[model samples]
Target: MTLATKITLVRLALIPLYAWLATRYGSSVSAGQPDEPFRLAAMAVFLTAGLSDALDGWIARRFNQHSALGRVLDPLADKFLMLTALIVLCVSPWSAQHKVPFWFAGLVVLRDVLSSLAAWAIWHRHGRVRISPHWTGKVATVLQLLALGWVMLQLHFPPSWIVMPAAGLFTFASGMCYIAEGWRQFHHGPPPP
Candidate 1:
């Protein structure tokens, strides 16, 4: 495996640690005793994973280490990380005071589910699916990550009131864009290479 893919694997490995720390912290907070150390550790792990995402991508491009495995694993790691973080922070009682809004999380989940289903359906019918990442989707991802960090770090300065809804809008917009792309591909065919 390439060094970039190895880095991506490390990011995936960190997810479980982040989850454990976050869960422990949440449990402590629910018990009316917040665990600051666990919370900080979770944040550190999360930030490391997030930064490694960028680092790996840069390495793949800069060092010419791109591979089919990297393409697949990178997005899989991102989805797993985001979904895990969203569920843990939003559903946990510890984050009752400052959690990602349920609606926003729902939007993100719904978008991804629908996108995956659409791709599958198209591939099943046409034997292939052409999925080009849209700019809006990229923006939504960055916004979602920022929102996650804001919540995880317990940043109350600007508040979730400002963060989540903005993320939701982009999430919705990107979902629509993907839906339209899927519809076109389904009816016509995968675009030419």
Candidate 2:
């Protein structure tokens, strides 16, 4: 297997580990007290998984090992990791007060769903694929991580009120960017008669 594929697989493996740690520690916390050991361990796991995201891409680019399979696997790993973390953090006892609102979660899932459908439609009609990560998408991912971290850690440390709204805005912006880009790519180099 290529280095990119290997890196993607490693990243994918980390997702479940991170999610397990998050849910485990987050659930272990008492109603009014923080579970320091579990919280720290979970945070470490989450940070490690997030770091692997950048690490895999760096390794792939550095080794010139980019592949179609890597492209698919890498994003799949990211979406799964983030979505799982968010779900766990939202439901964990530690995050009961700072849970990710259902509307935000719905919007996030809807964005991903629409993007997938757009990609599929493009493939069906044009026999092509576009997987470039946009700046807005990157920002949105960052916002999500920050928000999830805050919610997960809020039992030990109070979080700023800005995170939730910021996350929501970035998520909305990313969705809009994806929709615009998908439309442009679909219609590019075409002249409707």
Candidate 2 TM-score to native: 0.83
- TM-scores of all predicted structures: 0.96, 0.83
| C-alpha local distance difference test of each model | 0.91, 0.76
Candidate 1 lDDT, 105-132, residue by residue in tens: 8999999999999999999999999889
Per-residue accuracy of model 2 over 1-193 as CA lDDT, tens digit each: 7876786787778777777776667666645555677777777877777787788888888988888888778889889888887777666646557677776777788899899999888777777766677888888988888888787667434454577778888899989998988898787822332
RMSD of each predicted structure: 1.1, 3.5
List the candidate 2 regions with Cα displacement exceeding 4 Å: 30-34, 155-160, 187-193
Poorest 10 consecutive residues by lDDT, candidate 2: 152-161
